[model samples]
Target: MTLVLFNKPFGVLSQFTDRGSPTTRATLSDHIDLPGVYPAGRLDRDSEGLLLLTDDGRLQAQIADPRFKLAKTYLVQVEGVPDDAALARLRAGVTLNDGPTRPAEVERIADPALWPRDPPIRVRAHIPDCWLSLTIREGRNRQVRRMTAAVGHPTLRLVRWRIGDWTLADLPPGQHRIIG
Candidate 1:
């Protein structure tokens, strides 16, 4: 079984097949060429980084299943600088429209070391944005983006830096490497 780690760039879909829809955009075919491998987990088309792909079904499930409790860490840039109280709310579970999320390991951090996005995030001089290192074991749909928004700081950019024992490390955007 071959396992690969890829830095999923922003605006790339996680699937291999394109269904010929106008908004379906670009699929994994546009980047990766590994024939039998499938994505172990999903990152929304707008989000980026640290995606795992594997030919083994068991390995894919092991990484994607929440029961594994594999921590996924994201470098999130939000609309405003969050205070301690707001950060605490993030550390404690914040209530989203769907339900309450599990408490995250959250902390303020300096702007991440990253390659610039193709269509860079819009900047507002007066907004005073900030970056955070937020880690969670759950893989809810768009959870990171929703979490920051629930805390009154909408996320401007979200990049997954690590997933379980895997990390982006030295991989630049659109890069991939074989693991095992």
Candidate 2:
């Protein structure tokens, strides 16, 4: 059995191959060389951090399947300092275009010490931004970004700090490590 934790960098595709792109894009293939291993879940091209990979199908399903409800934690930087009401709404679950989300474990967090993102997130001089530590069991496309947007604070940067029992701890961007 093989379990790999990858620190996916910004602008990097979650898949090993960038099959349909009109131009070349960085992918897991650029970083990971282990044969027969596939990403357990996807991290958006614009997002960064912990992306699990596995050669075992059952293990991959356990990590990636929403039915398993594995908690995925993100350190999010948002455009505005969310008010108590906004935080409450996020904790209680907000209605998105697709549907209402399950309640998430969320709190305003101090800005984490992280490697700088390539090209960096935009900074607005007039509008102050803040960080949040949020954990969700469901994997929806851009769910964290959408959920924060629903509360009027758009996400500027998102990093998956942990997924299930694995973490991005000590893993720098564009690096991968394999464990049994």
Which residue pairs in candidate 1 collide? none
Task: Tell me how far candidate 1 lies from the true structure as C-alpha RMSD in angstroms.
Answer: 1.1
lDDT of 2: 0.94
**Poorest 10 consecutive residues of model 1 by lDDT?**
17-26
Q: What is the lDDT of residue 176 in candidate 2?
A: 89
Per-residue lDDT tens digits of candidate 1, residues 145-168?
999998899999999999988999
Candidate maximizing TM-score: 2
**Which sections of candidate 2 miss by over 4 Å?**
none
How many collisions between residues are there in candidate 1? 0
- List, residue by residue over 1-114, the lDDT tens digit for candidate 2: 999999999999999888987999998899989999999989999999999999999999999999999999999999989999999999999999999999999999998999
> Each model's TM-score, in the order given?
0.96, 0.98
lDDT computed for candidate 1: 0.92
* lDDT (Cα, 0-100) at 21 in candidate 1: 78
Q: What TM-score number comes out for model 2?
A: 0.98
